[model samples]
Target: VNGQFVTDNGTNIFDIYKEELLKNPYTAENARIAASHYGSQLFDLAKNGFDSIPDLVLSISYQNGSLQDIGQKVNYGVKKTID
Candidate 1:
């Protein structure tokens, strides 16, 4: 999924993604991993200006009612100034 974050939007991308993860049953273990990874990335991005946010990629697989090697790729566009 592609998303954009603007300061005045009052919406946090990470929070929405975390909620989605919680709602998905097949994403138990990988969800935590993804959250941690993305959370760190977000922190880093926030620390240096919102520019240069990269695409997040992870490997994910579901087998026998279990998730294995879970991964996902998402791109986010952050606009520090809104017109």
Candidate 2:
């Protein structure tokens, strides 16, 4: 989120993952899939997202240079997890 905290409903995805999935790979993968699904749901908000969101989404703008660069920097050299 924005500087280590979510500015949303206070439901921290990372915290939920840690509390529910951290100890088990299967559980973690399940959470990952759920996250993916939730992400896909963002298409309704717009392929990008509402302006209040902190980052651009994958499907809507995967190949743009600026977005790729941002993803690269934040993702430890990995870019475009989806596209």
Candidate 3:
């Protein structure tokens, strides 16, 4: 959160996080969130600029073999709920 949350600037922060995520193994057992939410979180973090924010939301971790695996998991979960 040691940054600014300006509109264009926000995109850069999200891009960095995404780049980091993509470089890691998809099944690295790390937390993952929707790209949009990730972007939003980056925005919030930038705005906070290292300040403590009350009740910040965080993502949950899951083990996925690849991006395809992540997609399948999401699809399966949704299908199960719909069925």
Best-matching candidate per TM-score? 1
Native-referenced Cα lDDT, model 1 = 0.65
Model 2 off-target regions past 4 Å?
1-29, 46-83
Model 2 Cα shift for residue 32 (angstroms) = 0.8
Clashing pairs in 1: 58-71, 58-72, 59-70, 59-71, 60-70, 60-71
TM-score of every prediction relative to native: 0.43, 0.24, 0.33
Comparing 2 and 3 on lDDT, the stronger one: 3
Candidate 3 per-residue lDDT over residues 1-83, each given as its tens digit: 24644345455556666667767787224535655666777676767655666665544434343222332445433224554
Go through the candidates in order and give each one's C-alpha lDDT: 0.65, 0.51, 0.54
Write candidate 1's Cα lDDT for 1-83 as tens digits: 22444345677777888889878998765898988998787766766655676666756665556554443343222332234
Best by lDDT: 1
**Which residue pairs clash in candidate 2?**
none
Question: Cα lDDT for residue 53, model 3?
Answer: 69
- C-alpha root-mean-square deviation, each candidate: 17.8, 13.4, 13.8
Better of 1 and 3 by lDDT: 1
Model 3: lowest-lDDT 10 consecutive positions: 63-72
The better-scoring model by TM-score among 1 and 3 is 1
